[model samples]
Target: MEMSELTALLTPEGLRLLDALGTVETTDAAARAVSTLRAAGHGPDLVAAVVGQAHLRAKARTKFGEFASRMLFTRAGLEQATRLSVAARHAGRLRTAGITHVADLGCGIGGDSLAFAGAGLRVTAVDADEITAALTAFNLAPFGDDATVLHSTAETADLTGIDAVWLDPARRTAGHSETRRVAATDYSPSLDWAFDLATRMPVGIKLGPGHDRDQLPAESEAQWVSVDGSVVELVLWSGALARPGVHRAAMVVRGGHTHELTAPADSEDAPVRELGAFLHEPDGAVIRARLIGDVARHLEAGMLDEHIAYLTSDAALTSPFVQSFRVREVLPVTPKAISAALRAGEIGTLEIKKRGVDIDPATFRKKLTLRGPNAATLILARVGSKRHAILADRVDAA
Candidate 1:
């Protein structure tokens, strides 16, 4: 939003209107609201701002939950903001470290700052983007002086007496509705500066889970977090924030359950063996943290392929770190042969998963005409030097 548009929306009349409008979940509802507001003689800027925020609030629910209702957001800000649950976890870490005041550098939409203040820590939330800073101030307005929102670059923000720091450097070009990835060298606050600050005090830096593991600092603890199977972020912790005897960690959160796997160093790969009664797919965070070996050992499983992440074992075991599947039978590798086998079983619903294979699951699914009431999972994997097609059933842990 433009500065002038934001100026019109910060007033009492505008926020009340936004609250009254609620969320516009559909394009038709959005158009109706815009027309009604325009008919009521509201200025174009105020109408646009309220309508846009209403739309954003609807979209923000997935990340911010109910709190999104009272918060203002830009499209890009909402996209980059950390999920509330994850932010709260970060806040707990700082609190456990005995940090009283923390500086959140490049605080996009104040996600971490909100968590910090809510966890009873004083926060200095700084952002280089003027509009994002203003929205953050509004989001954290409830905390009053406990949360200080600043419209300044992280490099220029005064640290003063802060005990801990959180850095979320911009990895994309500045934008509102659309953004593209930029080279990490162009990141605001620079990795060099952020890493340097970590040496003096506890610091946490958030990066994409797929970030180059080789480029990570040797002195920090890297934690890969996955929510509901998707690997979300890789956080590097330094100083007291870094746990002792832990250089690599994987935090998997599914629904209300949370599990963590940590190791002092990269784990060795489990020995490869032939397919057994059950197959296991390590969670994305486990794969990213290179801790699959630990999970495999826990389940008494071995790698199905020397290079692939899939695991297999004769024992019927499962854990939060892996999605377990019961191997039904080995099927023919060709799509036509697979289709014939699927049709013979009257399987209508199929979940196709592929690894170390060149086939597109979607296109291959279309090739098979499913018509029965049965449902099954199809795993296409490369075992040793051979490609194998296996029918499997998802194991529901008891």
Candidate 2:
């Protein structure tokens, strides 16, 4: 957005019009709303800003919930902004660690700052982008002076009196609508600088979940978090923020419930055993944290294959770290044979899950002629050197 457009949008008149418009659910509705506002004497810039904000606010609801209505966002900032629930977890960790004041470096739209303030911590939120810093200031307005948004690069931010540091470096090119990923070396303030700062003070560094584990600082505690079912981010905690005896951790958040597993070091993989009646699939966070073997050990399970992550056991036990399934039948791996077997079993509404295989679930589903009254999950995976298809029923966690 241009400076002129932003200046206009921050005005009382523009804000009133935007609030009056509320939310524009569809493009057709937005077009009609734009025409109505224009006919009512609103200028073109005001109309455009309000319309754009309406769409962004609607999209922000998934991340900020009701707070999205009161928030202003740039497309790229909103996309990179941490979800309110996830940010709250981060804030909770800081609060529990006795961190009262924090320096939020590269605070995008003040998502983490909002959470920190809400958790009763004084926050100094900094962002290199002027527009983003302005938006963050507006979003954090309710906190008064407790939340301060600064328009400055993280590398230049003065952290003299800050009790803790939270850095979310920009890992992508700057664009509101389109952005491309950049390397960690290209990150704003750079990972090297961030790590150096961590050595001097308690720090929480947020990075992509796929960040190289080999590059992580040995003294920091690395935690991988998954929201719902997708692995979202990897957080490295340094100094006092790093938990004792917790070098690796996986936190799985699903439907408001959180489950965490921590280990001092990577666990060894369980031995490969013959296929059992039950199959278990570890959550993505666990896999990313390399804690799958821990989950397998907890269930007294063994790997389906030496190299694959799939676990099997004779017991029908269930745990939060893994999704368990009860095996019903083992079928041939070929499409024709699998189709005949499924047809013979009168199966329909198939859920295809695969790992260690190159088959696209959508394309493979199209090849199968499924027509039956029954429904089941089909697991396609490699068992050592051979591919096997297992029909199973999902076992819900108790």
Per TM-score, the best of the predicted structures is: 1
lDDT of 1 by residue, 309-354 (tens): 9999999999999999999889878878888888888999999999
Off by over 4 Å in 1: none
Q: Total clashing residue pairs per candidate?
A: 0, 0
State model 2's lDDT: 0.92
Return the TM-score for each candidate structure: 0.98, 0.97
* Top-scoring candidate (lDDT): 1
Clashing pairs in 2: none
lDDT tens readout by residue for model 2, 1-398: 66676888999998998898898888888899889989999888888889989988999999999999999998899999999999999999999999999999999898999999999999999999888889899999999999988999999998999999999989999866689999888998899999999999999999999999999999999999999889989999998899999999999998899999999988888889999999999999999888888899899999999888889999878898888999988988788988987898899889999999888999999989798899889999988788889999899875
- Roughly what TM-score does model 1 have, to 2 decimal places? 0.98
* Sequence-dependent TM-score of model 2: 0.97
- Which pairs clash in model 1? none
